[model samples]
Target chain A: MQKQKIIFISLFVLVIAYFGGSYLYKNWYTQNLDFMAKENTSVFIRPHSPIYGDANAKNYIIDFFDPACETCKAFHPFVESIMKKHPGKFKLVLRYAPFHTDSYYVVQMLEAAKFQGKYDETLNVLFKYQNRWASHHSPNISLIWAFLPEAGLDVEKLRDDMKKPEIDAIIKQDITDGKTLGVTKTPQFFVNGKPLIKFGYKELQELIESEL
Target chain B: MPPLQKTSNLAWNILFLCWLTATIATLGSLFFSEVMMFPPCIMCWYQRICMYPLVIIFFVALFPLDTKVVKYAQPFVFIGLFFAIYQNLLYYKILPESAQPCSQGVSCTSDYINWFGFLTIQMLSLIAFSIILILLLFFKRKAI
Candidate 1:
């Protein structure tokens, strides 16, 4: 009986050690966001403004997003609401990091609309119709064109820009930038060039408010 | 001679099952990505690292290799188990209150692929660990 009890105790200790060690390793490796921030080597819009960070603002929030990502789509409205509430206090730049092939076209289309100063409107429409057009199969280009009028851009100019090299370059640069920053997923944000430790709208808002 | 033959057969059976399960899970995940169009998160990549090796390891174990190979593999499986358990804990949110276990993407806890609400990468790891433990125990018993 005593030997059996000892065996049970040994097994229990091993189980505990296995679980405890695993937990520690996961937390330690995953929570280190500083490592990613250091790896960012993408070209910036200006000094200290990598794609999404504010160029001239003291407090900038940079969101690295993929146009076709479901998570990015889910997180868009919350970010939009924050931007609406704090316009000048927070400058928002949308950097395109295309994870899927479909996202590349979406980014290109959005950039094309920028030529007509309808970038923000086009972005909102893209986020809204992301699910519709983001697929491994061919997306409905007609639906994309339908939103051009709503975004206050001429359809012809938008179509022309979609096929432009400049738009492709812009999208490619964002991907290049994302790789440098160690951003592996969509909807990743940085506050004042520091990657936010916690995710969620409330956490992001708190970080922004604290910075201000 | 009879006992040795039985032991060899048991070992082969265990290795075959492990290989089959690992292969099915991996191929299924890839198919899901292609068909369902869900992008693999960072945690999924780590799980892949732990699982992919089993395909080769198990195949080798099924052959008549040195006892040293089995000894070497025993530790590797344990290491994989550790990572899998760590991943599962992060997924279940049992690690720490402020554990940001997954940088810049869908967290390990997100459960992008949860079969029957419990079959997760962690659960798979638990199964793998149990298999290794059982094999180790069997070997020790045989030695005795």
Candidate 2:
């Protein structure tokens, strides 16, 4: 009887521990959403001109992306490799449609870099350090400036451009275009004017070839 | 039968019921999170690693329902219990919390799924662990 009583007490203690631990964890998880979770958005973009079969031997592809989106980050390297492989054949347009709060800053910074002809450099830095800003309070602006010389852009000009309303307008236009095309997620792509519905390198290659 | 035998049988019965309940809840949580749009956090993934195998392991244990099967399952349940306890400690902040930092696209600590105010992924693991521990104690006497 005494042994049974001891066993019962142990079981009761275990149960209490389980419940107590669970409650505490759940509270922490929910409260930290600002730093952890990304908000959903409905946005799309339209290219400057109609993208169809390259009548002028130039093909345009636009990627509507959110910097903080995991899928977009994963897709970046592949897209970059494609550009490197077929450099002049493809003219890629990158549009920012922020899906999460932090993403907006990345988009704004990228636009500022574009103003100084350092778009590619800024993009590479952002994607490479994606994990840092996605998890932390905010990114280091000094890091962005440090990469300016490597990107072959003037640091002072890049900094000045960051404060311009024109950069904000461009970002806004991308969002407006994204909404028009019914884009509600990150990494939405367009070849010519038609949205690429399927994902994967094979399908994207096929679609690009068909347009070519 | 002697009193020892009766107690052993009762323990086994309770253990079986607890395992069944825990397994069912785990499958339910998976469906709720994966298919139902709730996302799982890092601790949640660890709990999943512990619970997912039990669905198959317990079903297999049910086939023979003998001492041999109990011996085989004992280690698995114990290992699972260890992980569950470890996770509970992490969640409760009793131990130092360490998670793979968030990358641009994937937040390691992101908690996308929460149920009933307190039912996080780690909580589910604790429930499963407790059930298995109780069952193990019950079967220990019988195996002896």
What TM-score would you give candidate 1 relative to the actual structure? 0.52
Query: All models: lDDT?
Result: 0.62, 0.61
Per-candidate TM-score against the hidden true structure: 0.52, 0.47
Fold similarity of candidate 1's chain A to the true chain A, as a TM-score: 0.69
lDDT by residue for model 1 (B1-144), tens: 458767655655554455555555555555444433356666567666766776677556545523344565566567666777777776677886256556654555554457887986457656765676566556444432
lDDT of 2 by residue, A1-212 (tens): 55345445654665565556555644554343222222322232234321222244466666888877777888777766776666567666667768676566667777777666666677777777766656453444445555457667777776677778876777778787666554566787766554555567777777666766
The most accurate candidate by lDDT is 1
Looking at model 1, give its docking quality level: incorrect
Q: Name the runs in model 2 displaced over 4 angstroms.
A: A1-109, A117-152, A159-212, B2-22, B25-42, B94-110, B141-144
After superposition, the stretches of candidate 1 with alpha carbons farther than 4 Å from their true spots are: A1-56, A83-87, A131-142, B1-144
Q: Give DockQ per model, in order.
A: 0.05, 0.05
Residue A170 lDDT, candidate 2, scale 0-100 = 72
lDDT of 2 at A27: 54
